[model samples]
Target: MKPKAPNVHEDGLLEYLEDIIGYKEKQNQLKDKLSERKKNMLKQNKITKILKINMENLLKIIRIATIFRGERTIRFDEQDLIDLKEELSRLERFLEIEENELKAIQESLKDMR
Candidate 1:
């Protein structure tokens, strides 16, 4: 009996199956990465929330101490006030940076959709 020739349709079908498998693998990898990114974003959000609350509380305490001195006057010297102002400025800068980073991440996620 003569040798049989290879079938072109069978070869095409095998190639198509391999492509499908590759596509699915890539899709799964992307899905995992997206999940990780979302988790990271959630962590960042929590950090940002904590920072905001701390800043607000710090401001409130400063106001209450400085403005609402009733019996015993609290003495905050010039240097002390200056140091507190500097610390507040540092916190503000840090919060701004974190907020901008989070906003960029959110925008990128939106774009991916």
Candidate 2:
């Protein structure tokens, strides 16, 4: 009797290669998306840090204004107060925007995972 040819399909070589290729494609796509997200996150974090620093500076200015007035008549220049308030408001708005961006990036990362 002649010996039978080997059953190539039974060895699963082709199937394994196909799976590996598919997995590699998926990994590449995920890596690209992750890199983009990381860049965005870094940008947002930097903005947040800047806004926090500005807010702290505004608070320090307000404290100094209060300290400058020690008598019963504690008076601060209206324009100074207005400028400080405006700066604080701007910083708060910037912080909010950065926080939202960070949250969105986190959500996207979670979905990808």
TM-scores for the candidates: 0.48, 0.45
lDDT of each: 0.61, 0.62
**Residues 23-111 of candidate 1: C-alpha lDDT, one tens digit per residue:** 55765666676677666656766665676666567656766776776524345543455566666667666656766665675576566
- Where does model 2 exceed 4 Å of error? 1-16, 19-21, 69-113
Model 2: worst 10 consecutive residues (lDDT sum): 1-10
Reference-based TM-score, model 1: 0.48
Candidate 1: list runs displaced more than 4 Å.
Answer: 1-21, 68-113
**Residue-wise lDDT of candidate 2 within 1-113, one digit each (tens)?**
11332475453555466567795577567667667766765776676577667656766766776678653322455455567667657766765776676577567657745
- The clash count for each model shown is 0, 0
RMSD versus native structure for model 1: 8.9
lDDT of 2 at 79: 58
